[model samples]
Target chain A: MDWRWDFTFDVVLPKMWEAAGVTVWATVASFVLALIGGLILMLLKTHRSPWISRPATEFIEFIRATPLLVQIFFLFFLLPDFGITLPPLTTGILAIGIYNSALCAEVYRAGFQAVPKGQWEACIALNLSTYRTFRDVIIPQSLPPIVPALGNYLVAIFKETPLLSFVAVAEIMQISKLIGAEYYRFTEAVTIAGIFFLVMSLIAAFLIRLVENYVKRSILH
Target chain B: MVPRIAIVIGLAAFLAGLSVATFAELKMFLPAILRGAVVTVQISVLSWLVFMAMSLIAGVARAKASGAVLWLAVGYIEVFRGTSLLVILFWLFFVMPEFGLTMSPVLAGVLGIGLNFGAYGAEIARGAIGAVPRGQTEATIALNISPWNRMTRIILPQAIAIMIPGMVNLTIELIKATALVSAVTLVDITYASVQQNQLHFRTVEIFAITLMLYYCFAQFVRFGGDALEERFSRHLSKRV
Candidate 1:
C-alpha cells in the first residue's frame, strides 16, 4: 500500500548491486560459452558429411525446442546422481550457455547461408584451402550481419539470468526473493530488481543498435 | 554412403533400446506427464491468444495512434520487453497481492507470458505493417476509404502475410516460455516432470520425455504457421 523509499535505498539497492555483479558475471560467462558452442554447432551442421551434419542439426533443434528452465532443472537436479555435481553458478552458466547455443547456432547458420554461392566458388577457384576460405573469406563476411542477432541473444540471456535463481544461484532475482522473505515486504525488493533488469536491458539494446550501425557502416565503406 | 546409413540405423537402434529400458520405469509416470503436457498446451494457447490481442492493440497504437496513446503503447512494450519474465511473474504473483490485486497462479503465469511476448509481438507487428508499403496506404486514402477500411481491406492483408513468420517464431518462444509457469506453481508439463523426477529420481527419462514433448509442440507451431502463411499469401502468388 505504501512505498518505502528508505528501505529501498538503504537495504534493497545495496543488495541488488551485489547481486547484479553475479548476474552480469553469469551472463558474460554464459555468453562466451554460447558463442563458442554455437560456432561449433554451426560448423558441425555445415559439415560436408550428412553423418556429422544431420545429428548435429538434430541436436541443435532439440535444444532450441526445449525450455531453458527445464534444462537448468535437469542439470541441477539430475547431474548429481551421476556423480557429476556442479557448483550452482557453474550449472547455471552451463545450462543457459548450452540452451542458448542452439539459438546462436541457428543465427550462425543463417549467416553462413546468406553468403552467396559465388563466394565459395571463388574460394575454390582460387585454390584456397577450406580453413583459409572460412577464416579469410567466409567468417569476416558472415560475422557483421550475425552481430545484431547475437546481440539480441545477449540481452535475451541477460533477462534469462533470473531463471538461475530457481536453482539457488544468488542473482538479482534470487536476492530480491530473499529480501522479500526477510523483510516480509515484496514490493520494494521486487520492484528494485525489476528496475535493475529494465535498465540493463535498455542499455544492452542501445549498445547492440550502435554496434549494428557501426558494423553496417564499416561494411559499406 | 552405405556406412553413413548403417551408422544412422545403428544410432536409432541404440536410442530405441535406451528408451525401451527407460520406458519400463517411465510407464507409471506417463499419466501425470501427459496431464502436465495438456496443461502446457492449454497455457500456451491461452497466453498466445492474450498475447495476440495485446500485440494487435499495442502494435496498431504504436504505428498509427496519436501522441499520448502512442507513448503509452511504447511504454508498455519497453517495460514488458525490458523486464525479466520471471521477475514479472513474481511481481504479479507476490507483489500485486500486497496492493490488493491478487491473481491466481495460472492467471499470473498467463498475464506474465502474454505481456512479455506481446511486447515482442508489437515490434514484429509494427515492422510487418510498415513493410506493407506506402503506396498501398496511399491508394486506400485516394479511394477515400474509412480509416478502419483502409487498414483492414488494404494494409492488413499484406501486413498479416509479413507478420506470420515472425508471429510463428514468437509463438514457439511463447511455448518454451510456458515452462516458466512452473515457477509460479502452475501444474504445467515442466512442473509435473520436475515433481515426478523428485519423486522417482528418474531425471533422464522424465526430462527426455519433456524435451520431446516440447520439440513436438514447437514443430507443430512451425508447420502450422507455415501452412497459414501459405494460405494467406496464396492470393499474392495467384496474382503473379
Candidate 2:
C-alpha cells in the first residue's frame, strides 16, 4: 500500500510509456511481417507438389515447435558469427515475425479450407486465372472468418513483445527492469508495466471482438 | 509417403553434416545442455499441473458461479491473459522479495507460467463446458442427481472430451514457454545453450541441438495428449 506517487509519475510512468510505444511498434512491425509471411507459407503449404509443400510444412512445424525466446537468442547472438549481424530491434521483429508466421499460417490455412468448394469450382468454370481466383474470390471469403483468430494473434504478439527486451530492444518490460535496477524498487515500476499491458491487451481484445462481430454480421447479410 | 520419407532423410542428413563439422564442440556441450533439458521438463510438468488446477477453478466459476465470484474469475483470466509471461516472471522473482515474500527460482517460474497459462486454459474449459449439450444437464436434473454428482458424472466427462485437444495444444505451448525461465536464472535449456555459445562461440550447432530437444519435448506432450484424448473419448463408441 506504500505507493510513491512522485516516483511513479515522474520516473517510472514516463519511461514505461515511452517503452510501451516501442513495444507497440515492434508488435505492429512483426505482425505485418507475419501476415505477409504467413500468407506465403499458406500458399506454399497448399501447393499441389509435395516437393514444395512438404518443406514448407516442415518449416512451419519447426518454427511452431520451438520457443520464440530461443529463436530470438539465435538471431541476436548466433547470426553475428555468420557475419549477418542485425540490430536488436530488427532481430526482435524477425524472430517474432518468423515464430508467429507459423501460427498465422495455420490460421490462414484453416480459413482457406473453410471456404466452400463450389466457389472454387465456379471460378474454374469461368476460367478465372488461379491468381485471380485467389485474389478476388478466395481471399475475400476466407479472410473475414479468420479475422477474430488473427486478431487474437495481434494481442498474442503484443504480449510477447517483452521477450525482445532480452535482446536489449528497450521495450516496456526492459524499461521497467532498468528502473527497478536503478531505484531498487521493482514493485511500483514492474506493477505499472503490468498494468499497462493489461489495459492495452484488454482494449485490443475489445476491438477484436468488435471487428469479429462486424465481420460476422456483414457476411451474414 | 515416399516423398515424405525422402524429405525426412534429407533433413536428417543436412543436420548431421552441420553437426559433424562441429562434432567435437557439440560433444563437449551435450551433457550440460541435457542437464538443462531436464530442468525444462521439470518446470513444464509442475507448471502444467498448477495450470490445470487454476484453470478448472476459474473456468467452473466463470461458468456456474454468479456475482462477485464470477467477476473475480473473469478478472483473473483477463489480467493474466493480457500480461506478458516474462514480465510476470520478473515481478515474481524480483518484486515479491521486497514485500518479505521470497520464492526460489523454480518456484517463481512455475507460478508465473502457471498463472499466465491458467488464464488461457480457463477460456478453453469454459468453452468446452458450454459445448456440452444442454439435454445431458437437463436429464441429470430430471434424475434428481445431486449438483456435484451431475457435474462429476454427466457434464465433466463430455466437457473433458472437448477440452483434450485444446489442452494438448496448450501443453505444447507451455513446453515452449519453459524456455523463458532462463530469463529468471533457472539454467534451463535456453540458458545452457547461451552459456555454451558464450564459452565456445559455436552458436549454430548448440542452438540447433537445443531447438531439436525442444521439438522432441513438444512431440512427447502432443503424443501424450492424443493418447489421453483417445482414452477419454473411448466411452462414446461404447455407448453407441
Candidate 3:
C-alpha cells in the first residue's frame, strides 16, 4: 500500500477541514429542525382527537418505514417536478431534518411516556391545559434526560451529512470523493473524512454526557 | 380502537385512490421493482448473517472477555460505529483497491453494511448481556449449573428478549442502508426505482411504490422480531 503522509497533510487536509465546516453546519441546522419538528409531531400524535393523532402516527410510521436515501432523492429529484426547486444544500438539510424528525419524535415519545401516568393524572386533576402541563411539567422532566439521545442524533445527523453528497452539496464526503477522483488517491481523503466524523462525534458524545451530569446535579439540588 | 379501524379504512381508501390514479404506470414498473426487491432482500439477508456473527462474537467479547480480546472487540465496535456507513462502503469499494485488496461491488456493499450494522448490533448485544442480573449469575453458581447450561438456559433467554427490539431496529436500518448499495450501482430496489423514474419521469407514482415497498420490508422484519420476542419473553407476563 502506497501511503504518503506529507502529501496528505499539505494537500488534502485543508480541503477536508473546509468541507468539515459545511458538514457540521448541515448537522446543526438539520438537528434544530429535528428537535422542533419532532416535538410538534409528538404533540400531534398524543392529541386527544383521533383525527390529528392517527394521521400524525401514520405520517411518522411512513417516514420511519422508508429509507432516508430515497427520501433525499424524493426531495431533491421529485420536488422539482412539482415546481418547488430548492438549492441542493437546502434540499439535503430539509430531507435530513424531516427524516430524523420522525426518529426524534420516537425518542420524545419514549421520554414522555416514561414520565409516569401519575403525573399526567395530576395535571388532569388540577385542570391544567395540555400546553401548560407539557411545557411546565412533562417536557421539562423528559427533555433533559433525552439530551444524550438527541445528541446521539446530532452525531447521527453528522453521519447522514455524507449522504447529502449524492445531490451535489459539496460536503466533506463529496469533496473527498472529488479529491480522490482528481488525485487518484482515495485513501488519505476518505480516511481523513472518517477521522473527522469519529473525532467530532466522540467529542459531541463526551460533551453530551457532561451536560447530562450537570442537568442531573441541578435537578437534584 | 376507533382510530385503528379508521386507520384501516383510511389506508384502504388511499390505496384505492393510488391504484385508480397510477395503475398503468405502477403495473409497468412494479415487477421490475419487485425483482429488484429480491436483490435488496439478498443483500440484506447476507449482510444480516455477517452482522449477526460479528455482533455475537464481538459483543460477547466486549461484555465478558478481558485484555486484548476485549480491546480488540471494543475497537471493532467503536471504529465502525463512530463513522458513517457510507464511508465504510466507499472505503471497501473504492479505497481498498489502493491497499492491494480488491472486491466486487456486491461483496463490498455486503461487507460495508454488515460491518457497520454489526458494530451497532454489538452494542445492543453487550447492553443486553450486561442487563442480565448479577443475581442470576449467583443463582447459577449456587445451583452448580454448568457454564454452558447457565448461559443457554438462564441468562441468554432474558438477554435475547431484552435485545430483540433493538436488533430488529438495526435490521430495519440495515435494510434502509441497502438503499446505499444503489449508490455503489448494485441495482437494488432503490436503484431500480430510480431507473424507472429515469425512464418514465413519473416521480410521484414511482416514489410512492418505492417507499411502500421499503416500508413493507421493514414491517416484515419487525414482524419476525416480534414473534421472536414473544417466544423468548413468554414467561415475563404482559408488562406495560
* lDDT per residue as tens, model 2, B13-83: 87678567867756888878989989999999999999999988898888888999999999999889988
Residue A177, candidate 2: Cα error in Å is 0.8
**Candidate 3 chain A lowest-lDDT run of ten:** A212-221
lDDT (Cα, tens digit) per residue for candidate 3, span B1-240? 234345445654886687778788578877787888899999999999999889978888888889999999989998998889888888888888888899898899999999999999999999999988899999999999998898778887778888999999999999999999975768988888888888878778778778877877777677778888888889864645
- List where candidate 3 sits over 4 angstroms from the true fold: A120-136, B1-28, B235-240
Docking class of 3: medium
Candidate 1, pairs of clashing residues: none
Clashing pairs in 3: none
In order of listing, the candidates' clash counts read 0, 0, 0
Q: Candidate 1 lDDT, tens digit per residue, B136-234?
A: 888888889999999888887888888999999899999999998976888988889888987888888778778767877877777778789889998
- Comparing 1 with 2 on DockQ, the higher-scoring candidate is 1
lDDT of 1 by residue, A1-221 (tens): 88899999999999999999999999999999999999899889999999999999878877887799989998998779889978999999999999888889999999989899999999999999999999988987887879999999999999999999988899999999999889889899998888889998999999999999898887745
The CAPRI class of candidate 2 is medium
Instruction: Please say which candidate is ahead in DockQ: 2 or 3.
Output: 3
Q: In model 2, where do residues sit more than 4 Å from their true spots?
A: A126-132, B1-24, B237-240
Backbone clash total for model 3 is 0
Rank candidates by TM-score, best first: 2, 1, 3
Each model's Cα RMSD: 3.8, 2.8, 3.0
The full ranking of all candidates by lDDT, starting with the best, is: 1, 2, 3
